[model samples]
Target: MVSVRDDATMREALTAGQSGALADAYDLYAAAVYGIAVRITNDHGAAEDVTQEVFVELWQRPERYDPGQAPLRGWLCMIARRRAIDWRRRQVTRDRYTLLLAGQALPAPNVEEDVEASTMAKLVRAAVHDLPPLYREAIALAYFYGLTYREVAVQLGIPEGTAKYRLRTGLRRIGDSMSSVRAE
Candidate 1:
């Protein structure tokens, strides 16, 4: 086992593709990373996920950390913090949408209205499923996931304009499909 005190040597070993260095780094930093993630996320499961993500990122891209810029622990903590916050943001968005969908006021509790709503929802889901992969992803992220176009762009790693375009185009196709379904 490498000495945990020698971060520079550990980083060097990691950069040189040494697997033992990664295990040593995890031993030295996992608790600190998990602590930061739990503090930010307030969820043990999410904190564990964030901690795992931080370590996996470090393993995949060891060069992203410059020991000259920051200590390894600090770098790992920062990554954990960011991942935890992102996880929290996604959770908030999901909860908000779930509540919004659940709390929608029904139309006087009529059987006809309920049937229509169910049918429409099924049609929309079918249309969404029929969309191209990129369009479907954009629509799902923007509408179903309650993300703004910019957020969808960031999540999809696309430009904001592209996200907007895909969303617009996708919704138009879904609308057209619904129109045809209604006509039939």
Candidate 2:
């Protein structure tokens, strides 16, 4: 067992790439790092992840630590705290995205409502079909085909004012038909 008496010795041993020094460093500072992580994150699982990440970072980049700047315990605690806070931020962002996606998702279909709406649409289509040929053509061109009034006029070879008048008259006739059906 390598005896890590002080931070300087630990640094020297770590710089020399001794695995025993890493074990010794972990033994000395793991509890303090974990404590800081738990305090910051307030979650046991997240704290454990943060603790593991701190040690992995230390093992991967031993040269990053300078004993002249700070003690090993303080450095490890700082890393743990930062990792914990970052984990919390990531969790918050993930939860927000989940909620946003849920809000935007399509709702399940209602059988009765779907049936009623489909029946009403069929009735309206029948009424439109019963309209006079001139009005039926204009309404189908402007509404069903999503054409503007000017486009409908151009397509049907009629004046724009004539197209508008046909559309209005056609809609009124459909409304009257639907009203009569409802009354019966």
Which consecutive 10 residues in model 1 have the weakest lDDT in total?
A: 140-149
The TM-score values for the models, in the order shown, are 0.55, 0.53
Q: Which residue pairs clash in candidate 2?
A: none
Ten residues in a row with the worst lDDT in model 2? Answer: 1-10
What are the per-residue Cα lDDT tens digits for candidate 2 across 1-184?
A: 4443367788778888888888988887788788878887889988988989998888888889987765576677778878988988898778777877889654455899989999899989999999999999888766554456776787678999999999999999999999998899
Estimate candidate 1's RMSD in Å.
Answer: 13.6
- 1-184: candidate 1 lDDT, tens digit per residue: 7764456787788889999999989987798789878988999999999999998888889988886655577678778878988999999778777867999643343788889999999999999999999999888766644456886787678899999999999999999999999999
lDDT of 2 at 166: 95
For candidate 1, the TM-score is: 0.55
